[model samples]
Target: MDLKAGWDGTWQEFLQVDKTVFINELISFHSSLDWTLELEPAQRFAWETEYDLMKSMLGHVVRESNTNPETCWVAFEQELIGEGGKRAADVNLVLPTGDLFVVEFKHKTEASEHEILRANSDLQTMLRYHSESIGLVGHGYLVLTKPGAKEFKHSGVVCEIADKGQAPLLTNQLITSLRQTGSYDVLRWSKGEFYRQPSILHGTAQVFFDTKIPTLKTSASENIEEARDALLKLYQHAKAKLKRYVVVVHGRPGAGKTLLGISTVASVARNDSVKQSEPIFLSGNAPLVQVLQHTLDFYGKRKGKDVLGRAIDGRVMIEDLHIFKKHIKSSFGSRKETFVVFDEAQRAWDKASPRDSQSPSELMLFCNWLSSQSFGVLVLLVGDGQAIHRNEMQLEQMLADLDNSVRAQNGNIVAIMPSLHAKNMRLIKPIKRDVFNLKTPIRQSYTEHLDKWIEAVLSNNSALARDVALSIESDYPLRVTQSKSLAERYSVELQNTLHEGNRKPDAFRSGWLMSSHGGQFIEEVQKDKFKPGKRIGPWYVEPPSSDNSCCRFDAACTEFSCQGLELSLALFNWGSDLLFRDGQLVLAEDNRHRRQYDHYTEGSYRVLLSRGRSGLVIKCDDSETFEYLKNCGMRVV
Candidate 1:
């Protein structure tokens, strides 16, 4: 019989056959399998399920057929040879337009990796055959029962067959691409014309679009909310005033800049009229890009519409602002309704060299573009001046550049400064005042107690150490130093001690060690011969208990400073007559010119004061300094 007749007859017979008998056959195959034969049952099941789904997937391709006859022949169970004649493939169907489809079957019980590899291999082989066929078999598709297995990485088009309880739905995106290409033969072969199912697919995509995308909102603290509200008011005012306006928001680190940007986008997107012109969220940060892409993908699936324009549909484009600017200049040109939100505005404005002059800063150029747009466009700039910059301009100059850019475009500028440090500053007050008070009487009597407490807290409680470490700002400059030879000796000794004590020391784990120029230091001690679990660092002379040693480079010290110190005591030990000698509490006399010195001195003072939680433990290195501090109500230890 011909290929079409054979497929129809085989399908009818397969469906009429008793399901119990088919299942029994599968079980028998499973029972009588070796390594090669082990996959027989899964293969057999997949073949049957894929054959069933092909009819639905093929429907989409068939509808787009432009053949004179209006009806096309379908071939199944055909064996075909490739170019070298060394490989052969069992094809599921060949359409009248000469499109070759390699079908694979998969069950939920099959290993996912195996299925993916198999699908990829089959698609590659089909692509090879299709290329040789010279558009005869215009495209190749791998039809499978596994709906979620959609990512086939080969070049040519591919599709997935989603088996609904009643009838399967065709989900191969190749059909859409073929239709969009406007190639009649390719469309017919891909079955683009016949497939007309609803766009909603059962999975994360569906949930994201219908629910998550529409309701997406920015997370904000009290100050952030205030700033967001203010920005929204400005956006509305601009929208009313000139029908559009450019807004610039600048601040320091941990400021609520991103929060305001997201809120602005969400507010504009939620509007009924502006919903069609969805705000485009772009960023250079990989993690942030992934989050935004995921959000956009969810939105696209649920909406059942191409919301992010045809070019960006079902995909998130991540590129530098320069590339994005080129695209905008080409694609949108003078279109004013579409809103583009560029996060990380600092990177966009970097023009340090002649090479950069050609790109022009994205911030400045974008503002200029908004000014020239006929219908007016809203440009929002959100960035921190302290983080990373391309220029050597002062804060005043940076602000001036922003102001100049706004004025040059006749745009409005607004500033919002939200500090995480300022918000969390209150939480540390109790610990700072009563527990760490240097002038308190309790601190005077319990000088030794305070030292032991800090040691005990660091050694026994990892969580507390992490908290304390994080509490210390990065500005502190306390450093720890040790000779390289001594460090190596200590590392070997510590490893040996741990092994003798029946402890399995991890090479990666070491106690907090100090570095001389600020920052924690940890290094593995190398012995005469390399040994497993034998390592040394500044923190310990012997391998400390895992509970007693926090992982080096793993502590949370975003706002704190730490250093390794060589001391005789297992815990905190200090000499008698611990006295607070008058030590110079260095302060940054000038913030702009001496910022580094200012940070170091201020942070050192904070750390010194905060170290004695229960009371001040002052060791007098200088009598004058001690007398000065003592007269100031500090207890001398």
Candidate 2:
């Protein structure tokens, strides 16, 4: 037989053995044959060992079945209703006194004391037997090979090989009485068993059911009834050429980035008739990769090999390509047809200067190789530009290059490149005043409170102080404090907090931290000395640890590091004079002592004004510059 067939045969044998053991115990308990002789050799030996253990542990009542003929009954397996409405017990014994006993026969050696106890607490079965008005007696029968001199106490009766001889006669008598009375009711109890909570068990079971599996619906595009149709069309269009291509899919979080990548891989696999290969899902963040792995594994198991095999080989490999490229190359080889999907592509490429190159950027190198080889490669870059990591600028640059290539090759880039940000807005509830497109901005009850909160932060009023005092308040003001030495100072303070009996930091949530430049600041934060708390234009700053603590800043330092992506608020130190042109953002022209401001008449000022979500906060030593920004619709703090 083949390996799979052999394994199947073994599995069937295991199941049959289990069923036989269950049946034999029930039949022997009800039969008139001698219990000791009636049992198989394995069961007899087991009964003897259990009896000896019980004798030593409990020192309880013990009698041979031959001596107590009145206690015998004809036992049969009975089904009981469970959470999913069906479960089975080993035996239902009918006594001469018209008492029907539900007995669960356990192979004592295989169960822990706790497990045995839990098994006996099958209250549903007991209730059902009771409701039937039969003489219901619940029991757990421990059959042993030999009776021991010592004794033990447990939830149920312990029977030995010596008593097996009388089982047949006792069973016959009970069956005869049960036949005469025509009714019996009794519950047999055992101890120390535990089952997974019903809901969890039901959920797991449901995952395997056909109706519970989730199906991929068609995208909201014209002429597409299913994802397959769209996928097929994409394949047909792309299949003619054997060239490297980067497909850019722009969407917000939860916009099916990973799903689209998987489906694309599945589509390619289907067209090529590949049996076992799945897309290599790559990401930089370890936690995010773990989440993807779990999700993929769940889907894989549900679909099983038949369905999954059609998509790829039986394996769906997910790894951090930054660290696993060598392993991947060695395993998969440099085959043209082997597709590699880079998820979170924005975070996978290094951002360090090309002149100061310490290590080669795998993403750029891979794209270059694919282009050089003229391979039919489909590279999907799925992530919003807003969410790109501060350290992965090279990948971003490569994506820009790919976009240029697409525009050159495809003629109209807009027609081929699709953005799904609008569709994603429907899936999630947004924070107050968060606008996607202007018409569909999020309308929330918290808008008024949020606006007031923003006002307080910008004004740096007494309310801002109070809000900062209660860091965990529901209406907490967002504070972004910029400092060049913040990382080192924050680390020292965190260590001090630990020394003062505070636990390790765990309140931080996972999200993207943005910065304009790659420098010591980013390195420090990555190393845990500095952490991101919130964003305020061009500067990502760590939140205060608690109301009692504050951000540590160097008092002598004049230059402050600001958040990267956008600039909202600008802070000037005490006694420091700063200048700002009307409607222009005040900024240091370079990382130098001299500071200069640009007038709003310059185009650069347009980008600055758009940075603020609501209004900008300007902390100026002089009132004039503050008033200038305030008049320009920026709230001065």
Q: Give the top-scoring candidate (lDDT).
A: 1
Worst lDDT window (10 residues) for model 2? Answer: 1-10
lDDT of 1 by residue, 417-462 (tens): 2232112332121111111011111112233333333332323343
Overall lDDT per candidate, in order of appearance: 0.35, 0.33
TM-score to true structure, per model: 0.31, 0.31
Local lDDT at 67 for model 2? 22
**Cα lDDT of model 2 overall?**
0.33
lDDT of 2 by residue, 453-537 (tens): 4334334343443443243221111222233243233334323322221232221111112222211222222221135532121
Prediction-by-prediction clash tally: 37, 68
